[model samples]
Target: MALATCATVAGGMADFLVARAMGRMGGGARLPPRVRDMCARLGRPLRERTFSCVLVLRLLPVGSAMMLSIAAGLAGARAAGFIAATLLGSLPQTVVFVLVGGGTEVNHQWQVALAVVLFVISGLGGVWLLRASRIARADRTT
Candidate 1:
């Protein structure tokens, strides 16, 4: 479990570094106009609330991890805050993954069910957080 957690963090950190570098090199110019617009919309909130935005993005399974990292980097998020949020937000999914992986070996139905439940809860929470962030951003603009 500790190894898995460490590996996940390392991978996330690497993704962040790559994105940050790309951002520094005008990566947005390579993206499609639509994607650039979406990134701009998302980027504002991410810039204002770096930690929470990263945490919510990590929790939500909808978007590409690499894209999120890129958007965050382009938004000028601090590395320490981004990494910390990624680590903290990844805990729920990590727990679910560990539980499901171990349960599969033992063929435990209940454990699998619990893992599913946790996954559902995490998804719902991610949605809620995203919505709240959007609303907060709207409020701030008004």
Candidate 2:
């Protein structure tokens, strides 16, 4: 249990930090003029949204964090927001994975349950976040 928890938290934090560094180092800030203008209007709130999206992407598959970090940078989110979002979004999955650590059975039903729960929550959350982002972008346009 402890091992799983540690792995999850460490993995999430690592993903966040790695993404932030890569984003900055890669000059991801060199976005198009339109995006730059949009970001100028976004002010600080953009940072929070970027963090949420990046963290969500990180919790998925391996190497996903790299791509998401780049996306966040290009999208204009700050490092602190990225890290916070990664940690906040990853907490639930980390807990679930840790809870499932005790199962030893190959045919364990609990494992399936855990996977399903994770999938549902992740999918729902992703949709909600995306919608919110779209709304935010639209608001900035007007």
Candidate 3:
């Protein structure tokens, strides 16, 4: 758990630094049109709800963490808020992975089962969060 926490914090900081540099360098101009469009869409919510958006994105296992970091940077999120949210959101999966990995070495079936259950719940929560964010975005636009 300690190692995971440290790694997550380091990784989040690294991502933020890289993305912040890229944003300063006008990196978005080099992106393809489709990616730019996607970024624009993603950026809006991040701008509106910096911490929650970062937390939700981090919780979702589907997207690339680097991409999210870049998007948050481009959207002008503060480093402190972004990093804090990333660490908080990353705890669930980190715990699950640690438990499952340790459990496998000990051949603990219950531990593995609990990890799977946690993973499923996280996925569901991510889906719900995405849907809610989208709805809120639409309402704001209208």
Candidate 4:
């Protein structure tokens, strides 16, 4: 458990550092004016709530870890805040997965059952999702 947590945090920090370096070096790219304006507007909120946003993103299994790290770095997040939020946020999912995967290969019945149940739930939920295109169409009609 401790080992898993440490490894996860270490990996996250490493990614964050590399992305941050890229962000620092890439700051001078000559983006178009319209795109640059949009980016500045969107990046404002991220800078304001760096820790909370990163922590929330970390908690979810969204699988865009590199992107988030890069964004955070680009947004000029403090190293301490990024690392702390990452450490705390990595706890729940890591522990759950470690526990689920800790079992021996021969006794994998429960793990399979749990995976199927979760998959079914997610599939069913996706069926009724309110898409952005639908919302935009409805708003335009109104």
Assess every candidate by TM-score: 0.83, 0.51, 0.84, 0.62
Please count the clashing residue pairs in each candidate, in the order shown.
Answer: 0, 0, 0, 0
RMSD of each: 2.5, 6.0, 2.5, 7.2
> Candidate 3 regions off by >4 Å?
32-35, 134-142
lDDT values, one for every candidate: 0.77, 0.56, 0.77, 0.60
lDDT for each residue of candidate 1 in 1-142, tens digit (9 for 90 to 100): 7878788878877766776687788876887786576567777777777788889877876677666676777777778888888888888888889989988866598878998998888889998998877635643673
Ranking by lDDT: 1, 3, 4, 2
Native-to-model Cα distance after best TM-score fit, residue 26 in candidate 4, in Å:
2.4
Model 4 weakest lDDT span, ten residues long = 130-139
**Clashing residue pairs for model 4:** none
Give the CA lDDT, 0 to 100, for residue 63 in model 1.
74
Tens digit of per-residue lDDT, candidate 4, span 1-142: 8898898878877876765676678852454565444335435444665666666666555546655665566667777888887887766666556646764477787875665455444334333332311422332443
Return whichever of 1 and 4 wins on TM-score: 1
**Candidate 2 C-alpha lDDT tens digits along 1-142:** 5565556556645654654575568643665665445434443444555665555454543344434444455455766766676666666666565546644468777875886687577767766665655534644564
lDDT of 1: 0.77
TM-score of 2: 0.51
Better of 2 and 4 by lDDT: 4
Total backbone collisions, model 1? 0
Q: Name the top TM-score candidate.
A: 3
Candidate 2 ranges beyond 4 A from true positions: 1-48, 55-63, 73-76, 99-101, 104-107, 135-142
